[model samples]
Target: MDQCITEVKPIKGFYKLSMKQRMGFGAGDLAQNLIYQTVSMYLLIFYTNVYGISAASAGIMFLIVRIVDVIWDPVVGAFVDKNSPRMGKYRSYLLLGGIPLTGFAILCFWNGFSGSLTYAYITYIGLSMLYTLVNVPYGALNASLTRDTDEVTKLTSTRMFMANIGGLAVGYGVPLVVKYFSPDGKINSKDSAEAWFVTMLIYALVGLVLLFFCFSQTKERVIMDEKDTENVKVSDLWQEFKHNRPLRILAFFFITAFSMMAIGNSAGSYYMIYNVNAPDMLPYFMALGSIPAFIFMPLIPAIKRAIGKKQMFYVFLGIAILGMIMLYVISTNEALKGNTWLVLSAQFIKSTGVIVATGYMWALVPEVISYGEYKTGKRISGIVNALTGIFYKAGMALGGIVPGLVLAYVAFDKDNVATQSDMAEKGILWLVAVIPAILLLLAMYVISKYELDDATIDKINREIESRVNY
Candidate 1:
């Protein structure tokens, strides 16, 4: 292997990016978006409706899976950075981890398992572990692609755009597809569970194809020095976490962002079915949650340039908060009744804010990656990703746990295929309206503290390269 040359050049206003790099990096996100959306949006409903698992049990599984992520993420991160794999450090996992992920995901939806608690545990836990292996490496791959701030921004935008494309497909298509498999209009325990089986098989196969595309399209460049293959230690993990300020900021942001999205996404089915009295319309409304990403994600880099990242955060997060408020008010009001349009409108507004804000946040990881290298002459992309991966999973865990607990506490009865009680209705509303709104507000505060803008990051990159070459 040839020694890679490293340097930094400054840019003004928007970061410049070539279309190939942008599209290449974006492909990975599309795959991840599908994988994540399947879990976030559809998995819970599958567990309750098809698998015959109680909501509370499913919620516990969600939490357990996250706990498993905490243990697994660092290991994957450390292992990737240390071993120089033949297919490239991160890209190999797309196929390696993805194969099992696809298989497990399909199995999770399989109705032939006789619906045991133990079977659910095995499939869900294995799938979650495989997802972590793929996800942590993919995250590190982003930072490994380039050091140019502007290129990173473009990469982030393009990646997020592709990701939302996957999101839209899952959000919009899954419900309709699930309905297609159902002999009856509604999915319930009595519906032979074949609908979920068929649905999972479709998503898992589609997801596998997308992952292959990601593997084919992307390549890693400007990664860590080959000589830096020192064994990644437990102490090094603590050191990185202790020293990296920007890493801390991104980590906290992930927690809040994932939690907000998770709670809302997880609770969506219940909200539509119970409160809105339109079980059939859940996909359309849930699709609204991701639809804005298609419209707003392409505009993110432009939006960041026009408003500055911090101000953009303030504006978009505020928009999301406002949308949450509107949802709370509308869901609470009897005059609105069961108007699907009003609910859809609220979902659109809320998603518009969330889609752009959260989608663009991935761009910040590379900046922090550069910052970590600048501060400590060691560019451990895997460890940086691992650190942040902890927070992302943490947020997702909270999202899953909170809703699972809430529904369980309210005594949510999945067997009642027609109508739910007032308590269950309140629980669903809280997940959709109150809980997510609070998390978004907290996200705003955490993101406010994110200090690295374009100038500082550019300066840090130059300073680090200079220090290394000198």
Candidate 2:
């Protein structure tokens, strides 16, 4: 069975990773997600409520930043592939880009220039750019570590496990910790500015420490040669997008998948605080997003073996859609809306589907990169990551815009603390339920086109190994 993997003999290019080695690689994602998940889950609310801006304005800033990411991600990718630092190829950025990433991440939550769109633009853009610096290279790092497909599945599982730990920390912990520091113990309010800043500061520091540990533990073995590295170009990203069919399919999947995630996550605080009218339950609701990861992630190998990857995705994605439908039905009825267990149960199911489906997608990245190498004789991991990054941000762009537009259309009032109008509540529900469900459906169709089966990918990896050891 594929799930029950044992250590294999070291092939020319393929090799097994130890537990510490797996954890060390996984730590990079965990470190990044501390800031990434926090920003995704909270920054929009922070902008509207704590930073004293309209939801529409915050949404505009998110759109602009992601647009900038489209250009910036490729540059970082090309740059990384073009040069190798003495520190390491991909691992060097864990420190180089990470320190600045932490500073900007903390700054993004600061309210010193509250309601100043200029200040918001500067800090938020800075944070997004630096995030790309770390993210693009770290993606390359995953493929650079080993060529063993089973090892990558295990590595991705560990990475997602730790990534969800950061998600849990940010999801529940950000609010709970902010509440501890918050004036009147309220998280999303104009007066909670200081609390948001302090909470981010703590998370960012911990992230930096983990990046250091990752830098120490990760080594780059599977990479392009020094000669090949010199020729990597931004245009190569476009070339790969055109020529690599698997990359194209995965790229589109990224857009749809991330859009669904962003929309739901962005709308969650409002759903709980406004729709459910349970501000106290915000942390618990958000924590459900990551709790499923712990329960399900360890079982991934077996799950993949049992049903195969595509079927696993179909099953989970459907479960998520079912969860959303349940949320819509329950929340619409006055009697059922008051049922806390029902609301949380629906959230848990929805989160389980989303977490498992999206988390495992990382394993495909290395496969595509290997495919690219087999076809072109050059492994441009950064360029492929940048292409995926673009689509991922494209999804994020939709994620950023849709919520703001929906809220604006429904006339959501940041000032109205007690409750929103009927239409506004429905808008939040659409964000949490209806819209994301539709996108999940689209993601399902997009992923259905993926042609790489496990056997095909393994044969390709072996062929590449036989030709070039690197």
The number of the candidate with the highest lDDT is 2
* Model 1 spans with C-alpha error above 4 angstroms: 1-17, 467-470
Q: Please, what is the TM-score per model?
A: 0.94, 0.97
Which residue window of length 10 is worst by lDDT in model 1? 9-18
lDDT of each: 0.82, 0.92
Candidate 2 matches the true fold with a TM-score of 0.97
Question: What are the clash counts of all predictions, listed in order?
Answer: 1, 0
Q: What is the TM-score (0 to 1) of candidate 1?
A: 0.94
Task: For residues 291-317, write the lDDT of model 2, one tens digit per residue.
Answer: 999999999999998999999999999
Q: Model 1: clashing residue pairs? A: 15-150
